[model samples]
Target: MIDSHEELGAELAEKVAAAGDLEALKASGAFDELMEQIDAGRLQIDGKDGFLNLMIKAVLERGLQTELSEHLGYEKGDPAARLLPNSRNGSYPKTVASTVGDVGLAIPRDRAGTFTPQLVPRGSRRTGGLDDMIISLYAGGMTIRDIEHHLESTIGTELSRETISKITDDVLEEVMAWQSRPLDPIYPILYLDAIVVKIRDGHQVKNKAAHIAVGVDLDGVKRVLGIWIQASEGAKFWAGVCAELANRGVKDVLIACCDGLTGFPEAIQATWANTTVQTCVVHLVRASMRFVAYGDRKKVAACLRNIYTAPTIEAALTAREEFAAGEWGQKYPAALKTWENAWERFIPFLAFPPALRKVIYTTNAIESLNYQLRKIIKNRGHFPNDQAAVKLLWLAICNIEDKRARERQKTRTTDKESSGNHLVEGAATAGWIQALGVLSITYPERLEPYLS
Candidate 1:
């Protein structure tokens, strides 16, 4: 086996080489010397012996001092120094203990002293009681009682429910700040939708709508723009939400895909006049399928698929008319009517390039976001209020944001193609603009500015 001095010298050499500049070299040398002293058993505490204990004590003391200085802005000679007063009159006491393996240095402390030691004791390397338990419990994802039992059994410490609640409650303010954060000015594509949750309003539990806005930005990375918990999902509420986004610097959105909620299209138009609203084709198909009999579901779905998958609007329309003339059409006129009513809005997607078509044709992107949200909220049967639901959903969205960031990074590393350029080409085409015009009449207020 290599001698201890050789190992220490190798470590010192590696650290010295890694040092960047003059100041870093000095710091590295100091740390290396400290390590050397401990390894040689040259440091002693109260007549106790070993190099390992002294190293641990030194590390703990330095860590506590750094935390206090950075977090509390405490400087040397400051009055706040008394809070974690030095053990040996501003010097650290070295107490040696047999239980501490390796380097032996025991730290001495005054029992009656006002200094509440934040570090591994003034001399001991054992961790503090409450703080360590709190960190462990949080890392384990244990509920309050489980955390309490864990601490009480493992460490023989009494942890109360109220204290645990207070600790977890700190996340509430963070959630609020995150929910209201500013968003980028232009998102090439946006997905908007709402998920319902049961929440207690006063004494009774009621359903509340949690509206979400997710977008693909200029860099092609998905981001959550904002989340709001409202009493209900309505045009008026969405109008206010749109206004809030505008105020927070969302200047433009090229296209917004959403479920067919009444007034949502109008709400989006009120904020961004040029924005195109793509009704969720999947939601439309599902709603239409609900009206068909079990035996007829497959046939009905086939006919609907024909309309959407057709190569052109003219071809889709011809197929729709032919299907309406068929026997199944006579039996399920309402399903056909649903498609007819939405046909004008639906066909505009065909005029765009395949890439743009894939994104605007459905609300599937937002649906995936909703699926993740449901997984998170599923365990909680109900919440205290709308704000509580909002907080949970916001936390869930933050989790998703991290996942999407990783996905975008990978996508950027692999794909270098641009999206949305063809969308402008389709926008300026006379035939495509005319096709959009037919649906505009049904949505006059929303389409007027774009038509002009």
Candidate 2:
């Protein structure tokens, strides 16, 4: 006779359920038994001692049987079953993806071909949120080997590093799908940056650049446009990136805030004729401070601030000219020249009001994102290849974007017209609403088509 763990578990579950409190259950040894079942559940992949895997499998199978009963129009042993047109038919074996690992299932069937499941569902490979959970853990800096051990200890299923890699590799498809998704026709602002990580290129570990593009929608919300991996950071690759953005529906970009990236402005102009390319003010200040003596850095930074914060572009230019003629500027000639060369790009944001200018004056928004990605990259140390690096970055991107989406869902948005202006409500009111007001006033002809 075969031993009945299921019957024993059911009896235990019933007694545990009837117990008055924790001490009562502990006195009956039910708690210890449950722990034993969990420890016993360990297996190479889908271990039997794993109470969670067993429970999940049981629920899904029971759900299938219940669905089968409904489809056949009779209970398992009802007299009506004998009279039914399409009675019970045996189940065929199937496997579904799960966090505990792949769950082997025997999905009950019917004589009729009409049984479509709702729990696991027909043609569905995974249930709910398991894949996201794996990606989240990986993004939070868990290596494949670490994640494998984590799943084994927490969920009682051991998966090979190859299996974990395959799971994360799936993110590449998602990243591609997201990259090709259509963009909003007009992005008021866009910030672009890159982070370099070491990846093995066949025989040698080489630096790989992960370029990230973030767009600020009209509502002032930040959206990560895409992540691209390349051998090096150069302007040449940007042309392709800009072209891809154009193809994906970015017809116009009002302002692009970036560091002193060569050839980037030309690449952007190639796509959107009227787009204004603005150098990151914060980056320029940092570069300036590097050249200043320690004693004068604060003063140099203050002078640079006065230039960017000046109410008018002409005033900002006047302040910059004064700074170039000052003692600190004379001492750090290269720093002044740096700003002078990029002044054409730096002055655009000055034309905006303080509320609007702050949003476009720097690439800090995207830099903040890079800070998060860099943390993940630092933990990984080095990846096996470009694909591995990209896969990890994409997973991190997914987790970050998911958190943003959840936050957006919790916030309310409003589009109210007041005195011939539109306000992007929700958190947008803080500055996005004001920035929209400025864009509408500043780019009337450009904003006209999109006004609803």
Candidate 3:
């Protein structure tokens, strides 16, 4: 038992040593002293009135004093103070809320009354980081009221809903700018989808579709083209959406993937005549399974997989005939008809090479994005207006993209393997090289011009 305990302790020490810079800190003795203080109960590293809050208080006071010294051109107790008319006027007590807690600060003043501390500005009751925290919580799907209660429970800081809303509202201008920004001239693939969100229309709450367009550029980075809110969708509405994209600098889209919606293909063709409209095969499979009995779903899915997985369109057609003749197909005629109706749109992807075919047929890129968006808006029972919904959605997208960027940065700096935190947006599409090569060969005339 003694030997086992010794071996365990040594193994844990070895792992800690190999962890990272923390090993160097442990070697420096500073971390050891901190741990000693913590063990002795002389330091409390957590809670509202802890070591961190004390450090924050010290830093802010030190910063304010430094600013005052710089402004008056001398140290607080320096003999040079006699030469200047402006002298130290002591400090006034002010309590400000921070991420740690409420920190009481002795805000230094000048005899001249001209000094202003930029670190913690006058009349500001919360640190900049506190506002950032509020915005982050809001982006994470917390309502203003929820955030208010959270801060109060965590840090004993009470904030009004109006104040929280104002802080979140700062992102609205950014949302507008992003919505109106220019897009790439050419997108190799575009995925169109909508998520239903409830919004108040006058006296009653109505469900609205917030349409999203995710475009994969030639470089394989997924980009959100724009978002649109509509009560209902049709050929005319989609045409306007396409036209809006065109107006925002999208010159061409090679292929647009969407679920089977009436006149949707027509709308895409009207805008970009050469663009191939591909129906989402996953949606087709799901629709087929809707009418199937639960016990037979797996079997039915297995049988229908033969059609989509077929090598060629003709083979797919033959497979479809086989499925139509099968027992499940006979039992559920509507299941087969769903495929038959979408056959024209579904078969376009069958002609592509295997790699490109996989990329085109899989709607996982947009489906993942919609899944995230839905989770974000799920708690917000309803929005007041379209802009409110868009504002929240845009912030959520920014949060997702920001996290991916930071993870990539950390991986690069640490010289460690990727965290595997790849997101569809701002990251290369999976198997993009093989897919791009096939696309280049398939549509050299249209694709090659934009490749360079």
Candidate 4:
């Protein structure tokens, strides 16, 4: 036993030394040779300590050497290397912590100290995989402190909160890129909603609204187009948001469903003159119930439902009048006024066929997204600034979308006929086909051009 252990230690030391010997590694073609052996069943990678570590070492060293070659404008043995003022200055050992384990890398250096390798950047203690893990945890609503504890408990890595925060901060650039990405020329439906969050502005923490716009494409797939932050929303603010969407290539929105957003209809009309602004029936009901007594909520909701569920615009108006004159409406006049306030937007919902009504009657699509988002941000009591808030929200959105994609992929494997547009928990807009048919007929000129 003692002799076998000694031999193992010696083999390990040799492999460690071999990792730093870049010249010998290159001349031997060790990576390709090892791969060939593995392919031929002469050697194996069993996720063990020595060989896997050696494999990681060889790959990192080779990559660094290639980067150095590119930087110097010559290969290792090329006669053209001598013409350049800079050359390889050997390598230093670096142990990068990856998901598999800690990998000892032979980071190459240049004579002029100008070869900054990007594969595993200089001074980086861990690989990009570790950073990605941290970002994923952060996106899943783990606070920096929680992530620190999680890494320590799981991987035995004691990363500082600041370090974890910096890792997550790298997502800001991606957020900016995603925010400015172009959209489709037209959307069959758009769901607009706002989620209020606390953000510190200067010295004082104040409430702010993060407005999200979700556009449903011709294929019935919903994607969050963009997120805009504002201290408060107004006609000018909403108009700016609409203009940004328009500039991002949204030529028109056939039907935009939203909660009672002040001046949102005007903003939509300003951007797309023919865009139909539909108030969310669920939101209107909830708004009316805001002033109603808790005990009267059920009765009030049923009464208000009659207004929104009426057969036609004329019937809806009559139902609204009946509700206002009814005892419950007179008892809760504010609830009645809520319906009166959104009557123009509400009538559009009445005009749509039942199949299309189910899609446009509410902003449930965006609301479900916001529900997940709230869970992510709930741990964050308040963001330091708007940018910080946007960054975290964007990461959370990415995490949500990724989970949905995985679900769709899984569903595709099992049920080949399933459309990939399903959201979380296999929930999607039912009757999208019928809804789309209605939309095409209603706006034939605008909708048909894109269908082709």
Task: Report the C-alpha lDDT of model 2 over 6-117, residue by residue, as the tens digit.
Answer: 5555445445655646899899898887777646752222345344555567667766777877777777889877776788778888877677666778888777777888
- Scored by CA lDDT, what does every candidate get? 0.63, 0.76, 0.82, 0.79
Candidate 3 residue lDDT tens string, 1-452: 42542333333333333433677758766567556756876556656656667667766777788899999999878997898999999889999998978987899999889998998887899998898899889888999889999999988788889988988898787778888988888999998888899999999999998888889987676777788999975667888999999999998898899888889999998889999999999989998899999999999999999999999999999999998998888999999999999999999999998899878896778888788878988999999899899988887877776675566566545232431222324445889999999989888998977877
After superposing candidate 4, which stretches have Cα over 4 Å from the reference? 1-91, 107-119, 413-428
Window of ten residues with lowest summed lDDT in model 4: 418-427
The lowest-lDDT stretch of 10 consecutive residues in candidate 2 is 418-427
Which prediction has more favorable lDDT, 3 or 4? Answer: 3
Runs with alpha carbons beyond 4 Å of true place in candidate 3: 1-34, 409-427
Query: Which is superior by lDDT, 1 or 2?
Result: 2
RMSD list, candidates in order: 10.8, 7.3, 7.7, 6.9
* Candidate order (lDDT): 3, 4, 2, 1
lDDT of 1: 0.63
Determine the C-alpha RMSD for candidate 3 after optimal superposition of all C-alphas.
7.7
Q: What order do you get sorting by TM-score, best first?
A: 3, 2, 4, 1
Which candidate gets the maximum TM-score versus the true structure?
3
Model 1 stretches astray by more than 4 angstroms: 1-59, 65-158, 407-452
- Model 3 lDDT at residue 308: 96
Best candidate, lDDT-wise?
3
Clashing pairs in 4: none
